[model samples]
Target: MSLCIENLRAWYGAAQVLHGVNLVIGEGEAVALAGRNGSGRSTLAKAIMGLVRCEGDMRYRDVRLVGLRPYRIARLGIGYVPETRDVFPALTVRENLLLGERKGTRFTTHEAYRLFPALEARAAVKAGLLSGGEQQMLALARTLAGDPSFVVIDEPGEGLAPHVLAQVAACLKTLRERGVAMLLIEERLTIARMLDARVAVMGHGAIRFDGPIEAFARDAQVMREWLFVG
Candidate 1:
């Protein structure tokens, strides 16, 4: 497994957010984590990146990730794209990509630009000046510039227009082809379907369902109880 989590628990100050979460991602595989609001999907991503106070086992390949800092985990080949799309507002598009580069990473600014030409067109513009969809693209592109072996992406398709979402999906597909494993966190199944990924449903800070995407589709009970909003 490229990434593995066993009995993972996390908290925000005194508020516990995760409860014994277990998951594994194989090399080059993509898993879509689906859930409604406040179900702890985002917490899982944060735990893996060491952003929250966490305990239990989180292993990235052979490295123990439990006590590591976020930057250390990132240097060990894990990338995170938070839902907030944390692009530097004052930085130009090219400068943002430059910051994401690592010592030996093969992924470069050229590849990032190729994946999203819109970003290249605005290379000289500050990130704060771009539209929301464009900012999202820049965030993803910046992450890719690091050439991470695994990535945890949170709410990637959130608030994106259909056309912009399609572009993001295409870029993710290309990454999968290049053997980068990913955990795609989302509330909607549209992008998951586009990626043909496995499904893992989260609720009450635990995994309620984990299976192939087709299995998730046929599980009316799981969908009604956990996914649908009445």
Candidate 2:
């Protein structure tokens, strides 16, 4: 497995967000994490990335990840594209990609540009100046520049237009083709369907359901109880 978690718990200050969550992702597999707002989907991503105070067994290819620092976890070939799209505002698009590179990474700035031509067109422009969709592309491209074996992306389709969302989905498909494992966090199943990924639904800080996407689509009870808001 690329990632394995057992009894995972996470916290921000005194408030606990994750509750004994367990999940696994195989090499080159994509799992879409779906949930309503505040259901701890983002918290799970943060826990995996070592960005939150977490406990229990969290491993990336047998490496213990529970107590590691964020940068250390990142160096272990785990990449994160936050929901906030935290690109370096002062840096140019090309510079941002350069900053994400690792010594032995197979992905390169040139490849990132090829994946997102809009970024290539604005290579010299500061990241802060890019449009929302363009910034989202840059964020994903920059993470790819690191050549991680696994990535945790939060809300890739949030607030994006249909055309731009399609472009992002295409980029993710390319990553899957290259055998990169991913944990895609989102509120809806649209992008998950596009990626042909398995679905894991979260509720009350725990996984309510974990199964094939087709199975998830067929399970109306699970959706009404865990995914839909009354």
| Residue-wise C-alpha lDDT for candidate 2, range 69-177, written one tens digit per residue | 9999998899999999999999999899999887777888888887788889999999999999999999998898888989999999989989889989998998899
Candidate 2 lDDT score at position 34? 93
Per residue, candidate 1 scores C-alpha lDDT tens digits across 82-184 of 9999999999999999998876677788887887889999999999999999999999988988889999999999899999999999999988998999999
Cα RMSDs, all models: 0.9, 0.9
How high a TM-score does candidate 2 get?
0.97
Q: Which 10-residue window in model 1 sums to the lowest lDDT?
A: 102-111
C-alpha RMSD (angstroms) for model 1: 0.9
For each candidate in the order shown, give its overall lDDT on alpha carbons: 0.92, 0.92
lDDT of candidate 2 at residue 177, scale 0 to 100 = 93
Looking at model 1, residue 10 earns an lDDT score of 94
